[model samples]
Target: MDVSFLGGPHPQRGVGVVAPFDFALDRELWRWVPAEVSLHLTRTPFVPVEVSLDLARLVSEHETLGDAVRALNAVAPEVVAYACTSGSFVGGVAGEKAMREAMTRAGALPSLTTSGALLDALTELGARRIALVTPYTVSVTQSLEEYLAEAGITVTDRAFMGLTRHIWKVPYRDVADMARRAARGHADALFIS
Candidate 1:
């Protein structure tokens, strides 16, 4: 018998991520993927608009995301994903569909977004009431709650740090505390938005 194997990050599959210019959790995202999967990333232009309406407008732009998806397609990834939650959810369910359609049309591959994925996950878990946790301002976090409500998932409780800058600086212990607080209610599941 012959046995053959190689060591050190054998990337057998590639996933393209169309991300925001300010996305800072690259390491966290990579950690969730299997070692056999490689990530190809392209960033869309982002203006510094922290307000809910302005930020929604900035992220919901199909043209910007389409260009980014096309660029990622040059790498021939098996799938493309829009990694921004706010951008994906701001337009509601219909808008999310359009965003996915645009990405697929641009790259000729399967496409999804963070918000869409979240909805799928929640449904798969049969979670009816969710405790929300976020590092965004109250207004932005409330918008997320509203989006989830549109999907018929009730929010039992929520925690927000009201942060707009230096999100990377938040301590894990603090996050854990917030999570604990959010889980205090009678929620079926916890969602960190």
Candidate 2:
């Protein structure tokens, strides 16, 4: 009956995550995290707008990010990650950098955005050309393409769903089909946004 030998819970390091209000991939995010680390996630304020360039801009405003980062600071995460793909890329590279800087200024922690991480991964893999798949309208998808291009990566092919809302509900079969369509051309990688 003596279970005291188990001791208290292990100390956990945390990564603060600022996700869009509609984000539904918390489990997916946790899958990549190590057992010893924890994710402290916060969402941007909900807005009436559906998923679009305007919505992306709204959710990722500097003031919004700063507020989210400050809230996460209470948990003392070692680093912060802005987890919206569209919001991060809609502003392009410069915007991504500014978002990180703003989060750092608010929380005094290292910060990164999803678009920045994507670029870093591409560079690490030496993937100069890629095929893109997104559940965004043409305009939003084009913004992502422009963002990638600014990072010197070419989009060799692409497929989009033209979706405005509930992107998390997209069926895996449909996504697979879209990926298949996008990957038909020569590409160093396939990026699903």
Candidate 3:
């Protein structure tokens, strides 16, 4: 019965995540996180609208992001991340930067948005051209494309589901099929959004 020699529990680092109210991929997010780091997640306030440019605007408002960041600050996360593709890209590159700035202003923590992270990943991979698959309307997909273009990346081929809601409900087989179609022609990378 001698268990006193065991070491103390490791202190967990925290990462704050601000997700859209409709986001259903919390488990997916956790899959990439390490055991030593904890994710403190908050959702934007619910808005009565389908997934669209307007909904993206509402969820990614500076005030909403500030409030979410303030809430997450209570947990003292080392960094904060906004976890919405359309919301972060709807306004393009400038919008994504503004969201990160707003979150930092609210919590004084390093901040990033999904769109910004995607751009960073592309740059890191030296991927100048990519094929894209999205479960969003044409307009939303166009916004994402514009955002990528602003970062000097090109979408050589693309496919979309034209969906305004229930994006998570899309079957994997369909997504794979779309990816296969989109990945046609030469591309440095394949992006599924």
Candidate 4:
């Protein structure tokens, strides 16, 4: 397995990076996903929602998926990840499917979304009942909860901050606080994903 990093030109942007608020905690686990000959990353931090021209609003979807595809194709990466959770889930299945097709059409590369990875990990862990925590608005959080439940996992508890932008502004203290709540009782697992 191989991995390469891409982001801004400055030292703060590229490899050995630590996002202020990474929806995907400890991306180090993806050590096995990269390859020597096929690695392409772009200087675009994974933001779940973007300015959607069609919708004329900042929706929880990947409007820059096209940019992602371009970056992948330009570098010819065999495997790539969009690296946003709520955005991918916000897109729901359809939006994700669109991303796959978009990547295919642009460079014929395979793409992965954080949401998809979460579902896979959840299944592997046999997590039937789980708790969800995020800094999204009530509407977005509710939608995410509904989506997870539809995936055959039961969300016993949920917490949201009703936040829209500056997702990194969410304090770690709050996340830790929620972790405590999510782990209080016995549920299959607590999904910080």
Tens-place lDDT digits, model 2, residues 1-193: 2234578567789999999999998988998998789999999999999899999999999999999999999999999999999999988899999999999999998999999999999999999999999999999999999999999999999999999998989989999999999999999999999
For each candidate in the order shown, give its overall lDDT on alpha carbons: 0.85, 0.94, 0.93, 0.58
Predictions: Cα RMSD each: 2.9, 2.3, 2.5, 7.6
Give the winner by TM-score: 2
- Taking the tens digit of each residue's C-alpha lDDT, what string does model 1 give over 1-193? 1224755444468999988877888988988997678899988886876636467658668898889988987889999999888788888888889999988898889999999999999999999999988888877787788889999999999999988766767888999999999999999999886
TM-scores of the models, in the order given: 0.91, 0.96, 0.95, 0.67
Q: What residue pairs are clashing in model 3? A: none
lDDT of 3 by residue, 12-110 (tens): 899999999999989889999997889999999999999899999999999999999999989999999999989999888888899999999999989
Q: After superposition, how far is residue 139 of candidate 2 from its true place, in Å?
A: 0.1
**Best model number under lDDT:** 2
The global Cα lDDT (0 to 1) of model 3 is 0.93
What are the clashing pairs of model 1?
A: none
Tell me which of candidates 1 and 4 scores higher on lDDT.
1
Ranking by lDDT: 2, 3, 1, 4
